[model samples]
Target: MAKHSFEFKKKVVLEYLNGEGGTPYLSTKYGLGSNSQLRKWINAYKEFGDAGLMHSRKKECYSFDYKLHVVELYLTSEVSYQELAIQEGINNPALICNWVNRFQVAGLDALRSHKKGRRKTLDKTNSKDATQLTKDFTIDTSMEHVRELEDELLKLRIENAFLKELRRLRLEDEAKTRDLLGSSTVSEDNSN
Candidate 1:
């Protein structure tokens, strides 16, 4: 895909923003490919304004914390990779999807950067054995990962239950102590 200049994107977006034309109309007038690219540029402009409209060739590196947050959002929410990237001001949606895919393939640890070189993958192209590995090995590994997650979830649930029970006991004990002190004061007044 051809990268549009910052000036070009900014002009087109501003024209649309200023009610000169809609994306389709602007796209046609400017000889751009389609309204979709214009829509993305408009969204980026809306999210980050002028700076968002600027085009840069330099690669961006997201922090580990930010990557984790985006990955968690993908895991727990119904938002698609593209929509989440737009909301989070990420220039490329595919990069976010890559993060999620890496997480799924190797868990959170996979999101970390590794040495730049070829890596081993499990898939083999042999026709006869393909289906067997596809169904058995992939499913087995995925299920094992799921079980590990379930175990962690169970531990967290147990800890939460323990904390809640401890809180309830403390509240009950406080109420009992308050009652005893109230009764003693009443008895002293009665005796006097």
Candidate 2:
């Protein structure tokens, strides 16, 4: 359903609550799905008052800093996406990717979610890891150490890429196997 402004929702909800009109009338008038939705608004208003109806213009989109931080974690740190998601209290890593892409293309404005919610906190563990990874590994005296770390990181990247490829191949193989088995079973049944 299309979103209505908070002001419009509040007006309908208040009218319903004050018995200026019944739920059905308000629902029809406001083009809401059902009386239940109208009731939810009324209940929300009653419980939280005007504060509950207030909407954040920012819409929970990721700030530019947040997007930069996520990219840093993925690129520099050894943290997995799942681990990062858990640390950031995000339910989906794809959302993070979306934020990253948005930041890359549209800059800061793209990171915003268009909903209001609590902000993600910085992962102290990841921050510490990033610090340690970059620390004292200069271009001159630490070249050897840098090379060693780079080799290890390269190995990890290869392993991660291989694992992803393996998973894709395995899924394809499974699908083909299932198809063959199903066809064989069908042939047997037809012959019988």
Candidate topping lDDT: 1
lDDT of 2 by residue, 141-184 (tens): 57877755864574466457657767888999999999999999
Clashes found in each candidate (C-alpha, N, C closer than 3 A):
0, 6
lDDT of 2: 0.66
**TM-score leader:** 1
RMSD of each: 13.4, 13.4
Instruction: Give me candidate 2's TM-score against the actual structure.
Output: 0.30
- The residue ranges of model 2 lying beyond 4 angstroms of the native Cα positions read 58-192
lDDT of 1: 0.80
Candidate 2 residue pairs in clash (backbone atoms < 3 Å): 59-114, 59-115, 61-112, 61-113, 62-111, 62-112
Give RMSD (Å) of candidate 1 vs. truth: 13.4
At residue 138, give the lDDT of candidate 1.
85
Worst 10 residues of 1 by lDDT: 151-160
